[model samples]
Target: MVSQVDNVITIARPSETPAPRAWQRPFLKWAGGKYSLLPELDRLIPAGKRLVEPFVGGGSVFINSDKHASFLLADVNADLINLYQMLAIVPEQVLTFARRMFTSLNSERGYGIVREEFNAQRIDSIERAAAFLYLNRHCFNGLIRYNLSGQFNVGFGKYRSPYFPQEEIKTFANMAHNCVFMNAGFQKTLALAGEGDVVYCDPPYEPMPGTAGFTNYAAGGFTWDDQQALARCCVAAHERGARVVISNSTAPRIIELYKGHGFDLHHVSARRAISSKGSTRETATDIVAIL
Candidate 1:
């Protein structure tokens, strides 16, 4: 039997690149996510410890973080969390669903039908992963916003035929397999860590006076109370000897909120919006390297 490390991709087959370390796709397209900002985050990784990312948005850090830790990944979005849980625990099911969705795509109507069909089913990982993919690809600019009723609220994208293949998705499945997946709110995940663990918090960004329209993706926008709660979680984690890092909009509200909260706040510039016409959104600073 070939092990997962076997660097063998048979002819007529690709996309099975052997991963020296497990890397899972961050299952959601978070509005203010920083998958493209890992270089900025690289400066802040603590030398060695088990790793945890409470927000784990698109898993930019969890999947790419040096690969030397007992990872605990969590998110608040149920379907998003379920998709990762499925990828970690059930890759084959996800692959099957991906292929089926690819073959079934004919029109926007077909995509909506599939979403409704899967959304009504029991909380199965495979179906959830496929639905998540479909929404991300078809939804406006890959935003994962939803309606208050829990229906995906992202409008159809400009793409005509959207398809995710079996081989490419297997990578996501293996990622889920490599780490522990959770549906807990950010605090619950933090509560599980201790001295030898490292937690990277990528909570949703807070809006500032000049850039108030930055966060509008999730069904219910994240709140100031949640931000305070996250800061407390980080402080508690710190007291337990764990290192905490946060990537969020460096707005005055956030900066003032965490000032002297025992964290070193550093500002790094980031693009503020993802709108059509590629809206020349404001370039704003976000912070990391929380001490």
Candidate 2:
């Protein structure tokens, strides 16, 4: 059986049918990654010739879903895009350099040194990309934050052992063969959408009330005006015959923004582990809007 809400289609399979195993997992541990919401996201995604992700945070949704023949993944973060580009061009080299860095710089002091080098822009692209991966794994809570001066500023993670995702990197490289990654903002990426495209956006979520909203994934944090602009872009893409799906916090303003644009909202519980304190981490309501 199947159900449709607006244009969003979801399959209701027989109880006897076994769930499909995840095809791939993202190597990076991003803050707002969609790994846990794959089942819901996959159901909402409509069939299309290509999948377009304007905010490809961790590359989990694109990596796991096999519905699209090609992908256009974009993000505002240049370092993240450079890492993906390098992986697509030279997976083995990235794997080798990252493996070495993980082994050599697996301490707090080493982390500080590498963070300094990465911010200083002293290393080549390949090495810098490796350092980015290393910092993402070893830094606190896998945060990719930067200061106003555009320097990597997250502290040491202090993990017992950060696993080197060799297989995950290789898997992403193979998948990247049909992908085009760009270092661009959501507006520019969404403007390119047209017929036969499915745009899935996982932007830095709007912070709920009474919570310290952590939108500073990049230097210029996402603002209310930016969120409004994103909503406008999604509506424009939908009007151009493309399917659009967006994930965001269930903030009142966020809900009102999507509702006003005629998007169908599907709320789901997402366990957020980005909090500094473990006790503060709990299940939060997230809305997946489709048009």
How accurate locally is residue 196 in candidate 2, as Cα lDDT from 0 to 100? 94
The parts of candidate 2 lying over 4 Å away from their true place are 1-16, 276-280
Those runs of model 1 whose alpha carbons end farther than 4 Å from true positions after fitting are 1-28, 119-123, 161-168, 210-219, 279-282
Superposing all C-alpha atoms, what RMSD in Å does each candidate have to the true structure?
A: 9.6, 7.7
So what's the TM-score on candidate 2? 0.92
Top model by lDDT, which number?
Answer: 2
Q: Each prediction's Cα lDDT score? A: 0.71, 0.91
User: How far does residue 119 in candidate 2 sit from its true spot (Å)?
Assistant: 0.3
